[model samples]
Each structure stands twice: as C-alpha cells, then as structure tokens.
Target: MTQQDAQTKPLTVDAVMARSGVQFGTSGARGEVVAMTDQVCHAYTTGFLQHLAGLGEFSPGMRVAVAGDLRPSTPRIMAACAQAVRDLGGEPVFCGFVPTPALALYAFGQGIPSLMVTGSHIPADRNGIKFYRPKGEVLKEDEAGMRGQVIATDPALFDDAGMLKAEAPLPEVTEVARSYIQRYVDHFGPQALRGLTIGVYQHSAVGRDVLVEVVEALGGKAVALGRATQFIPVDTEAIRPEDVELAKGWAAEFGFDAIISTDGDSDRPLLADHTGEWLRGDILGVLCARALRAHAVVTPVSSNTVLERSGAFAETDRTRIGSPFVIAAMNAHLAKGEQPVVGYEANGGFLLGTKLGSLEPLPTRDAVLPVLTVIVASRPGKIRDLIEELPPRVTYSDRIQNFATEKSEAIFAKLLEGDKDAQIVRLNEHFGAIAGAVTQLDLTDGIRMTTEQGVIIHLRRSGNAPELRCYSESDTVEQAKAINEQALAIVRDKLA
Candidate 1:
C-alpha cells in the first residue's frame, strides 16, 4: 500500500475488531494479545469514548484514569489507550500499575470514567480492557451500544508494525495508588487486624504491593510469600490444586492467622484460614454480605447453594455467570427500593449497590472490600468459624480446557433431549455412575441438575475462553470433588 493511502485509510472499529480476532466477553474485550494490535486497541478505546460521550459521561478535556495488571503487553495497551484518550481530546491519567478495583475506586472517587487493561484470571498471553462509566462498571447495554461505531485511528503514535512506540513514556505515576491504599485503612480503622499474623501470596497480582500495604496499614503483620516476577494467571473460579496445597503449607509454616491473595487483577480474592484451608469464593461472599448486613444478595446460579440454605440474606437473586448480569440484577433491586443491596460472583469479587464506608457505591466487583469485610467481621476468632456459621454444603469446580463450545452444547442437547428415563440413561452414559437420579434441572446460565442423592452438577461453556466448565455441589467436600472429577473425566475421554 502507498504511504499516503495507508495514512488516509481510516481505521474502523469493526474492521480492526474483525481482523484482530478479539471480541467482547463477560468483562471486557478479551483476546490473545498478538491479535490486539495497537491499532485495534486504539480504535476500540475511541469507540468506547464515543459511546461514553453519548451518555454524557465523557467529554473532551476530561481526565480518564487508566491502570493495568503485570502482563508485559499491558504497558503498550495502556499507551494505546492513553493516546486514544488524547486523540479524542480527553486526558488519560495513568495511575501506574495497580489493581483493577483500586484504580476503579480512585476513578469513582473522582467521579470520572476510567479503563483497566488486564485479562483478569486469564492467561498472560491474553489481555482485555474493562471500561468504567463515571459512576461504575459498563453494563451489557453499554457494550451493545459501543458495537458498530466506527472510529478513526491516528498513525503517528504507532510504529510501522501497528504497535505503540516502546520509547514513548507512560504518564507519571499518580497518587491514586496511595489514595487507594488509604481507602481501606480509613474505612476499617487502623489496627483492625492488630495482633494477627497474615501471609500474603504475592504471585504477580497488580495489587500485590498494595495488598501488603493494606494489611500492614491495618496493624496486621504481613508476610509476603510466593512473590514471583513472572505473571501468574490465578483463576479464582477454578482454583488450582497447587494453590490449594500452597495455602495450607504457607499458613502452617508461618503460623499465620490468615493467608490472603487475589487473581492477577486483585478484583477476586483468595482467603485461607488458620488451618491453611482455602475457602470457596461463594462462601466468602456469603460471609462478606452478612457482615455488611446486606438486605439483598445477587449471585450467579453456578455458585454454592449453601448461601441460600443458610438463610443469610432476606432475598437472593441468581443471574448468569457474568459481572454484567449480576450488576443488572442489582439495578433491578434498586428499582424495588432495596437498601444495602449487594452482589458477588463465585470468584469472591464483592459489589456494593449502595454507598458504604463513606464512599459512593462502587457498582463493580472488588477484592479489597470483601477481604476487609471478612477480616473485620471474623475478628477475635478463627476464619473457619465464619464458615461454621454457614450451612454445611460443599462446592467443587473444574474445566476441560480447549474444549469446543459446539461439543458442549451437543452433549447437553443429547442429555436433555428425551423424557425422564432417556435423560437418566444419557446422564449415566456421560457421567458414568453419578450419585443418584436426577430430580431437578435448571437452565439458568447453563445446565444444572440436582440429584435425588443431594448432589448438584452443572455444565456451561466458558464465557472467556474455549473451555467447558463444570461445577458440582454435595453435602460433603469429598463427594463434591469426586462428582467434579468424575464428570470432567468423562468430558476428557470424549474430547480425546
């Protein structure tokens, strides 16, 4: 192509998105980084701003905060985003590398729009950008509105390969990070965790440094563990067996009162009790909501059913497995005039629908809020005691990675095709000998079946990747884990 022609060729959002192979998902526009060329990133950012302008949330000269995870590609993505903001006549306030929620909190405090460039629990090779409106997270409607909007990309800021110039410096780190550090400190009060020894698994999360700061700021002795320079994608929904064991080992070795960590973005938390046992995110969600005395709770259908069985909340709403869905349900409760309404995903990212802690309600999932709430609520007691307060139901989850979405749907169709007898036959054919007969079926976000033997099995396509995820629940932990393993084993066999 001629240089002038190339320069004049307008970079449209649709063409860039189509060529880059990146698409919007549960949270943001997630895809492999190789496909997320600077040109594509810049176009998407402009398109996002264009949508915001229509909503009156954005205008020229307004400052938009930006943050990212520890991934190597994040800097360039942030640079592309910053340049886009500049090109569109808005200023990009680079908040350095901070947790997704931390940056969001700062932006919310400033009452301005913001963007976070991180994949969040996805692999390092992949990344995404989550946009925030002035008040809170972008909803499904916002995403839908942004599509099909064509935006021109500037060629000057990019290299010949359509990548941001590496030498171009990011904005000076802002005080927003420090302000976020003090956010928890001021709310929870100093020395809230005094006399407790906490272990932090510093596994390359963007919030690693700030997590330690929060603990220490609260007068809790913070010990850093598993500090890795390499980015580690910690999936809070599907906890790795190694993380489970490491939580225990670290707690026991250091005689920790609790061990805390988060996924790459620090929006989803991982909490281990003194016994070094990792608590499920749903369980943590339950405790956090009850501690805040929330009147209404919204969660995904795939989460642990124990929260309902415990009668912890006055009302419980279940949505599909996505932040957008959860946020939508919370808004519905607001329409009903419910106060202190809250929501959480199975990943343990807590969302406040109403203002709390002297701050306006941040309508996004937050790891620090839940971490602080659980810690303060379970004060002067063991973390496991909080679990004892809840009903005794166990949950387990696993996934068949690289599994095709079509195959998962076909298998489900075959299972749910026939009447009761035929369905049982098909279930057995796939899951071998499950606990008992299928007594109930729920098709909320995916296929969930309740067995007469008090077992629950759920299967759904991963919204963020090419995988089929399965969730199992039972009265006992061992039974729940067994159900998950047995079900995934069947899937693995079929895929093989």
Candidate 2:
C-alpha cells in the first residue's frame, strides 16, 4: 500500500453502519451501546460536521456544543464525539447532562452546530446521537448528505475493536441549564405558576433537577418525587402501567394540581391530570398550541384529529410520523408568512417554529414547554379542566415490541396494495370488526383508517425500534383504549 493510502482511509457513513449496525433511525443514528464504539461515534460526529461544513454551517476552529442524557454509556460516547470535534479542528463545549432542546437553544444562539448523546426514552442498553445544524435540527436532506460523505480518518487512531487507543477526557461543563430555565421563567413571568402545586416525577430524567428549578422560579410549589439512582427508560409516548399507578397514588397522596415528567432525554413529556390519568401526546399538543394562541399548527398523521375538531388554530396540517417531517411542514408555513407557527408530535414533544414575543423558535421537540403551558393555562382549574375544554375526542396508542421491521413492511404493503378503493377494502376486511365499517383510509405516514362511526385506527411501524405501533381515536377515552387494544391484538394475530 502507498504511504498516503495508509495515512488517509476513505470511509463512508454507510460502510460504517453496515459493519457496525449503528444506523440512522427515525430521528437520529441509534443502536445498541455495545455496537457504538468510540470509532463509530467519532465517524458519525465527523460525518455530521463534514455535512455541516459543506453547507457552510460549520468550519474548522468553530465551536461545537455537545451534551448527553443520564444513560450509563453517554459519557463515553460523548467523549468520543468531543475528540472528533478536536480532531477536526473544532472546539467542543460540553453542556453537561441537559435536555436536548437546551443544548440546541444554546448552540443556535451561539451560531454553531451541536450533537446530543441520547437514545431518547429507549432502553438504557441502547443509545443514539441527534445532530443539529446551526439553525435547527437536521432535516431528511441533511441526513442523506451525512450518509453519502466519504470521511477521511487514520486507522491507527482506533484499535482493532474500534476503541480509541487514547481517548481524551470531556471538557468541563458549560451550564446551559440556567438559560433554559430562564427562557420559560422570563416568558411566563416570575409568578406565572404561583399558587399551583405540581408533582414532578423525577425518574432519572436528564432534566429532572432543572424541572424543579424552573417550577420554583415560576413561583410554583414543586414536589420532586421518584428520583431513581439507576437509569429509568420512560417512554412518554407509551406510559408504563407502573408509572400510571404511581401518578395516581402520588396525586391521591399529595392532592397536587398536576403531575409532570419527561422521557429519558427529557424531550418528550408525561403530564397526568389531578386524577392521575396521563394525557395523550396529541392531546397535550392541542392544549399547548391553544394556550400559546398559535396561528398555525403542524403535527403527524398518527396524532389525534382534535386539532381540527377543536377549531382552535387558523390553520392545521398533518405530516408523516417524525419530527423531521413535522419541522419541514412547519418551515413551509413559516416561508408562506404564517405567524406564530408551531409543531408537535404524538409523543408530547412541542416544537415552536416561529418566535412568539420574547421567546425565539427552537424548532425541536421540547418537553417542558407543553407541560408548563398546559399547567399555566389551567390557572385556578386543574390540568383536567384544560383537557375537558378541548373537543371530545380521545386518542390512545401502544406498541408490540420485538416485531421485525420486515414483517411490518409486509403488512403495510399488503394493506396498501392497489388503488385507494382497493386499499379501503383490504383495511375494512382486516379491521371491520374492531372499527365498525371503515369509510376512509389515510396513507400519509402509515395506514390510518376512519370508520363510519367517527373512529380512527392507525397502524405504523416504529422507526426507532423493531416494534409495531397502533393508535386509535374515538369519542371517549374508554373507546379509544379499547380500539387500540383490539387493533394491537388483530395485528398480533396477523403476525402469527
């Protein structure tokens, strides 16, 4: 081999992913922790920086912000990313273990790129990295650009096992938590949450302590509960049964006005009413958007249709299931001169696309905004009161884990075969028993069927894991839950 060839190895992100099995998911690049070696993460971060550099969003000697969740493997992976930043002639500013949006806000304010080390509510054994350009989160196009780049690296930097031979320590923490807290406090005023009693279920979320500080700064009585030593994977989208019971018991014991929590990375939120019933993400989105007086709203197809039924916003749009798609739609609305535009997911991650008064647009999934907005909007009433004011539509969702991606694709292909009429017939034949007579089908993100009785049932494969997700909506919460359960059962039977 030539001397130059030995020193300069050309590697693409696709090649690394093929060999390491750590590929991009719905949001970011994710895989099991075991496969995310130092070399793999370094390559991923380098590719991200390379992509940004190409877009003129990054340059050598520029600063890059980095942060991570509280997962065990986060520190090591973050170290690897920091080393990559240094190796590429950029400075790494460690933001400590803060929420994803906090890091994004700081980086965007500083006009630099950022990377977050988090699996985002997934199991602790698995982890992921979310990349951000200077302006906002990377869209689908940026992801493709990262994958196609041929990164140059020296093989001697990593051992045969892909571990860095000599990894550098992460820099000291640069506190972004204060700014994040102040963002809400300043917007809502110091006494915005005065006279309210809130129970914050702090189950190992990266932003747990920050949540307490924010609540207190807003003059609310914040009761911190359920602080765990070990990492807890809390999926705000799929609230665990134990968490539900815990919220109920806590509410009863404490007589709180509301109970709020966040997922592992603290991007998606979990807000339970005074009675201990957790609100659905789409429901939370609707309430938050209404509270913010948003002129335009964009959400995923799997979200509840109440955004339209509530008649709150001047315009509402639905996109495919993912933040990237939602962000893209929100951007379009902004380009069209829509004021105070916002977007959210079915998982309660609120995204503000346009500046509202003093607050700037973050344009990423945020946990605290929706919870805080909903609580403040409730005022003297409880969280349930704000929920009751919305349209009488309920949505529920659950997933079947360990379901292969190929199997999910096959099911979608079979259901979406032929023309729209033929697709409707297939959907009715499969789900008629549970959903009455299917009248319409929406193939936006997945297969969403609307029955004649105004019931909605949506089936979409999980983009972050090998899970098949089912969502249902109806007039009542009971009916929505029942439909979700029955749909999952039918999908299971089909898989069998």
Question: Which numbered prediction scores highest in TM-score against the true structure?
Answer: 2
**TM-score, predicted candidate 2 vs. hidden true structure:** 0.97
Mind giving the per-residue lDDT tens digits that candidate 2 earns over 1-496? 2224435567788878887889798789999899998888998999999998888888889999999999999999999999999999999999999999999999999989999999998889999999998988989999999998786877688877778899589999999989999999889999998888889999999999989999999999999999999999898778899998999999999998899999999999989888888898989999999989999999999988989999889999999988999999999999999998999999999999988877989999999999999988887777888877887888888899888888999888878889998988888888999969999888888788999999999899888878899888899878989999989988898743
lDDT of 1 by residue, 49-97 (tens): 9999998889999999988999999998998888889888998899988
Question: What lDDT score goes with residue 310 in model 2?
Answer: 94
Q: In model 2, what lDDT does residue 467 have?
A: 86
Error of 2 at 200 (Å): 0.7
Model 1 alpha-carbon drift over 4 Å, by segment? 1-15, 154-160, 164-168, 357-359, 406-429
